[model samples]
Target: MANITAADVNKLRQVTGAGMMDCKKALVEAEGDFDKAIEILRKKGQKVAANRADRDSAEGAVIAAVNADKTSGVIISLNCETDFVAKNESFVKLATDLATLALNYETKDDFLAASFNGLTVADKLTEQTGVIGEKIEIGSYEKLDGPFVGAYIHAGNRIATLVSLSANVDGAEEAAKNVAMQAAAMAPLALNEEGVDSAVVEKEIEIAKDQLRQEGKPEAMLDNIAKGKLGRFFKDNTLVNQDYIKDSKLSVSEYVKSVDSNLTVTGFRRVALA
Candidate 1:
């Protein structure tokens, strides 16, 4: 058997971010062969990932990143099994780095296939699963781009949002960010009434009719009353029509118009830890 030194164990730990004991065990198992030790550690990660495949990864950080031009942005969540692992500085940094990398890709599958530190992002998540002993994975990936884009990450890293504006007008940054904040806080279902799902609209109308019938309203009035209720639903659930969180006296559309009458929210994406 080859002798394993503390230096060998520390080197493996540095390379793999594995715990000292894990690195030492891996080194010993590989009989002091550094390359073999790394392979062993990776196999351990794969095994751990398989074992935890069914575990819930509900806790971690939500992060957002925009390109230098601010015309595109991505929001992602790096999820783990517990809040303890979620709160680690390194874990949060990993999430932030992933979000930055994600800006180059349009979809989660492409981002996972992209390389990071000589490993694919998916492989990195598997490796982290072994190192952290949790089901580490990317829970969400959302991307948006337009004439101007802005992003917001709420405190505790639990929520993140991205907003796109119709034009990169003056004060566009502040307006976009405020809209992004509104998205993170209000959780709008769609950008506008037209963007809402048709099935959802029908369901709301049916629900409104039911509620009005329960209130003893006449059957002939159901259609008109339901139409009014549907309008209220749009005002409450759609992004542009919803009341601005910063200034409830102004609707989100009115507030953005206040910024620039020609500027409007083009798109938005929101993701939260789940």
Candidate 2:
């Protein structure tokens, strides 16, 4: 067996996120070959990680990147089992780099198979699993490209949003970014009422009527009551219809109107820890 020092184990532990003892054992098993040790750790991680699947992974990071030209943006969710691991510098860095890399991928499946730094994304995750000793995954990815694109990553990296805007304003990037941040914070479902699914609208109307009847409202008033509630739902779920966070007097659509910009939000995405 090759000699493996405590320093070597510590170095591996830092690099892989694996425990010190696990790192030492892998190094010893691999005869102190760092590359072989990494492989050994990954194999072990895959075996042990199966049991961690059910652990609540409600803490993680959302990362977003907007291209220099503001023509493209990507948002991704990198989920982990614990807040401690989610806040780890290594994990945050990984999430950032992955979001940057994912800009070239148009679909989630392609992104997963794409090369990340030196290894495939799946391999990279497996290696990270060995190091971090936690279950982590890429929960979602979204990309948008248009005349202008903007992104917002909320504090704590828990939420991220990407929005593509068609606006002629000189500061459209900044404005779109602000709006994207609002969308992430408010959890908007659509750009406007028309953008929402008809099925969803019908479902909401049904729920509204049921609630009104339970409240002892007359059947004759249910339609009118549901219509009023639907309007409120639109304000709650639509980006353009929402109350502007910066100014309560203006809706987001009204706020955007000041720039004389024909703002058409072509795409938007939001991701949060599940």
For candidate 2, write residues 1-274 as lDDT tens digits. Answer: 7988889998988777788888899998999899899889888877656767676667788999987888888888888888998998978999999888888888988988999766789778767765677887888777788888888888999888888777546778777877897898799989888899999999999999999999999999999999999999999899988998988898887776655457666677888765
For candidate 2, the lDDT comes to 0.84
Span of ten consecutive residues with least summed lDDT in model 2: 256-265
Question: Can you list the residue pairs that collide in candidate 1?
Answer: none
Q: Candidate 1: minimum summed lDDT over ten consecutive residues — where?
A: 2-11
TM-score of 1: 0.96
Report residue 248 deviation for candidate 1 (angstroms). Answer: 1.7
Q: Once superposed on the true structure, which residue ranges of model 2 sit more than 4 Å away at CA? A: 5-17, 207-225
TM-score of each predicted structure versus truth: 0.96, 0.87
Which segments of model 1 are wrong by more than 4 Å?
A: none
Query: What lDDT score goes with residue 156 in model 2?
Result: 92
Candidate lDDT values, in order: 0.93, 0.84
Q: Give the lDDT of residue 267 in candidate 1.
A: 94
